[model samples]
Target: MEFIARATAVVGGAVALVRRIGAPGHQAMGPSPQIPEAKAQGIMTLKMPVARGWKEGHVPTCAPGLAVNAFATGLDHPRWIEVLPNGDVLVAESKEQAGPPRTLMDHAAQATMRRAKAIGDSANRVTLLRDANGDGVAEVQEVFVQDQNQPFGMALIGDRFYLGNTDGIVVFDYTPGATSLTGAGRKLVSFKPHGHWTRSLIASPDGTKVYAGVGSLSNIGDMGMEAEEGRAAIWELDVASEKARIFASGLRNAVGMAWEPATGTLWTVVNERDGLGDETPPDYLTSVRDGGFYGWPYSYWGGTVDDRVKQDPALVARAITPDYALGGHTASLGLCWMPAGTLPGFGEGMVIGQHGSWNRSKLSGYKLIFVPFANGAPAGPPRDILTGFLSPDEKLAYGRPVGVVVGADGRSLLMADDVGDVIWRVTGA
Candidate 1:
């Protein structure tokens, strides 16, 4: 079947995608009407029973010592952050432009209609927030750099910083004592942004390789790139040489990447293909292996093929399923392998940020969670460490965790909340 046909087949379910982007405010998280196409096929329902036992600590609040900044001061949607040796956090803010359709001056009517009604023109930049004198609170912030082409992800390596966004990647010269990012950055490589709107990034532990993720342009079909040259993939590049290659493919949205110190494996938290309704293909967490594929368009978690996309025979043979599905439509982000350790009330674990759900009627996943690790890797179920980002009744969600970094001290953690524009710190007592 043609991709256009597959796209048409799921047009009814596409409303959920719109709702995901457009639905705003707190009261929207309730038992809601299902999208007919999604519900009829049993795809978009919020079926998971809430785990009542996942109790948060008595301090039902975002931790103190939040250093709000020039980035945090005006950042409407911050997505990722990194810390330099001096203790200042570098923040990435993702802002979107949503409104009436921008006209396309094309003779082809079909092409004109293809342009999005809500077009996004964005910028990505970094800022420095410091808590002077070892105080729990941040005292100063400086605009390190600005004017990035819609940046989203970051990692600090040596004297330079790398950032990934919708358009491509850039390398910044950074030092602990630098007041601001001066001069220009080196352009690593470029990719056309697909519609899922996330570019998660992580550099290897040894500082030799860099991995930048490119999510699918659509939910499940190709934009003529996959069958030709696979686009839904984690791109690995040599930091020094800037030689880039497709590290892994078939993932819908591998929006989170981290290096596990215990095993040295690259782990990714993904936002799988949607439109099966609410629950067909579960979003996932998996160790990303080089040159491997996590099936997308054709197959989903545990070989549940997306019928609409599977209709395209071209995608069937290449479909490779996922490892562990982390539940449906959780919108998983910010994968970080916990530095091996034990802390009060918290088990040894990996940290994953669920940016929160939009497709379902009742909202799910608006917090930071730690997935327990046993010997050295992800071993147990996820435990909620930070709650109340969303309201008690689950109506109003005030924040979304977009990034997590284990501090140099090893026991403390820093969280970047894109929605609320603050860097929350979680300290172990």
Candidate 2:
């Protein structure tokens, strides 16, 4: 096992060096990112950071005119968040479900993730945080729901509270101001579990439908398209009839979804495929149209063919171009719509939690960013909202930001830091 780990690291470093020299491309960020030609690599790069929790009096660096505080801390793998009607905060304390490594590559990958503290047994629970005193910190903490199958998303529509479990959408009777879910939940929609296990969900504007993101089972469908049925797409579920249908297709891994208030359109942040050099494809944020298809497996960024997987000319031709690129392998997982003036000096736009990168030589993300918008569309470059999650030498990570949302007060922003096990609240300094 030690020999395999050392061998993989040596080969990965060499391949990464060669790829970097050959492509030496510009940073693939912003609306128009440079998409280089794909260079296939058999051995995956694994430049992961060693996990290092924050020391005393340490906090992430916030942008000027902003301040950050620990809203809640000492939680277990908090990955997602939802604001309740009565101003309570719901945090999905979960992690990746560990499966036995089947191949040598899988063993190496699992070891890498373990060392980074990125993979672990799922916590399968949700906790509630209440800040009754109006301070930025959460004064009360309690378990809201338990025994879930790796819950990642939560939504409350009318008297129904929807929980996004790995294998299905579960609905429970919700009473306003309730702290704990006591009633049994009924499965609203079923999904295949394991591969890309995050099931992020959002309710429609009118609260009539629920949208869930299902990522592809394998990168570029290496496991065959049959294994990808009803995968790599967003599904819309009808609340009244309990029926569901594919709203959009070919989104590789759409983890965060938000409703754009300006145009009332649904928007999402997608994590694109990997192993295609350092900057061949970029993860993106875009407005999702009903029945629209964004390219995956066959192509990307509006008809630029990946030349990987089996070709589907018809699907590739109709693939929709994303609105903005958030850099390659940034793993931009958390997104929330920000109205104008929510943060002083910042305009209406989106706040993204880039979970950082492990597959690239030099890392990207590991921070929070804001994209400016005008007339309901992205109009300018993105600005940094938070940073300093990595060590000075970039060899260790103190925290990784995941789910981001507007605080219950509607002024501050709440972000989930899985590595640090803390919920950070960002407000004007």
lDDT of 2 by residue, 122-150 (tens): 78999999999998889999889999999
Candidate 2 vs. true structure, TM-score: 0.97
What's the TM-score of each model vs. the native? Answer: 0.77, 0.97
lDDT of 1: 0.62
Q: Best TM-score goes to which candidate?
A: 2
In model 1, state the lDDT of residue 319.
Answer: 54
Q: Each candidate: what lDDT?
A: 0.62, 0.88
Error of 2 at 19 (Å): 3.9
Clashes of 2: 0
Candidate 2: list runs displaced more than 4 Å: 1-18, 22-25
Instruction: Enumerate residue pairs that collide in model 2.
Output: none
lDDT of 1 by residue, 1-429 (tens): 134323532442354445445332332111121222333333432211111221223222532332222223445356777767777777776654433323321112122122211123454667777766664456677777888767778777888888786778888887667867877988888876646656667878789988988877666664454532446789998987889999888887788887766677788888876555454456777778777767776665534556665354445455554545565567778777665453356656678787766555455677777777765555655677676666665434566666877764566677776656666667653
